[model samples]
Target: MPIAFSANLGFLFTEYALPDAVRAASRAGFKAVELHWPYATPAADLRAALNETGLPVLGLNTVRGDLDKGEFGLAALPGRETAARAAIDEAIAYARAIGAQNVHVMAGRAEGETAERTFADNLAYACTAADAHGIGILIEPLNARDVPGYFLTDIAHAARIIDRVGAPNLRIMADCYHMQIVGGDLLTRLTHHLPKIGHIQFAAVPDRTEPDHGEIDFSWLLKALADAGYDRPFGAEYKPCGRTEDGLGWLKAF
Candidate 1:
């Protein structure tokens, strides 16, 4: 099967218009597109764009509660329980509205006084709401280099949490960039954790640019995914080195 690909619209920006970005993605043969945060564009406008272009939104990153003030994740902190719950609810509502199937849950810092039990309780609650809306929560682990002190920085740790949560609707959003930065044998890891992964994103390891430009052999990696029977979309969540179309020419042959 030809793997379905989705463009992350946020990176396609060039001080140009949003519709132009959508057009570029469609012209490049992307059947689906995802926005990092749809907050700037009215939900009605986003819906209309999808209608006009006939593209489904693969997923959207959840709202962040002012990271400048040091807020990170809702699922792992006690003080932000109320805010975290609200963010999850907001994400679920938006996903249902935009016909998106998944929401990326930002894993915040694990520091300070909050008990591990408290964080687990909140995550369960958030997962329950997501399950009701027919949306899956994608918990992503950031590499320690990019995000220090963040909980769920390791894939193995994330898997352990998913096992603890044990909800069908909650799963890992594996990013090739972070995994490679963390220095792992990705093919072997993917084979071991296939069942827990709900989504996948790709980019060159250190630069976070398009796939073919990186050290990772994307053709082989994508083939590995196909061999593993991964049915979901492989999210193109990378910064375009130049024009989005030029960056994506490699996919034509894939």
Candidate 2:
């Protein structure tokens, strides 16, 4: 089958509320949808929206508290084990409620051995909580340029954490936008890390716009992913230059 596409509701459908975004994505031809955070709207409402539209929610992120306050993620912060686990549990419950297949565990601003240990412990807890439901736990590497002081900014480091946790349900949420910014060897990294990847996302490099207008050619990248046997949906997680629907020519072409 041809590769599927998932709309990133958080970024694309900003004009509408979460439930409306779900319907919009489905109407626009996305096979699935992913959310950055869908907590503001009740889970039942979101689930109803999904059911109404026949669109599956592929994944969602663990709560990233107060971005304006410089708080991004919580999984790796030292001395915050209780809070991290709480956040993870909350995400797992929400994922279960909405039938989401994966949850991206965000690692906050932290460093050194302490951060590593905390991150691993938190992930193990998350994996254990999500395993019974068959939900995958994902860890993503944020680009330092866009998110300064993010604990997990290197894909290799993320792989190490996944190995250390040793949880079958734990995997990487490889966002091509961040990967291209922090580590430019896209194809090689994607090929090498295929075993650990749970989900894939993309946006234009440098500008965070539509995938087709990037320095990185998504057509080539998507073809490469197909060649490498990646059957999962590729997420469109970019800020549109105009109306979200107006900038979907690439999706139409694909």
| Top-TM-score candidate index | 2
> Candidate 2, residues 1-254: lDDT per residue as tens digits?
67789999989988998999999998889999999888879999999999999888889998886569787888898877887888888899999999999999999988999989988988998999899899999999999999999999888988988889999999999999999989799999988999998888999988999888768989889879878978888999999998999889999776
Candidate 1, pairs of clashing residues: 73-108
> TM-scores across all candidates?
0.92, 0.97
CA lDDT of every candidate = 0.77, 0.90
CA RMSD of all predictions: 2.0, 1.1
Give candidate 1 misplaced runs (Cα > 4 Å): 13-20, 112-115
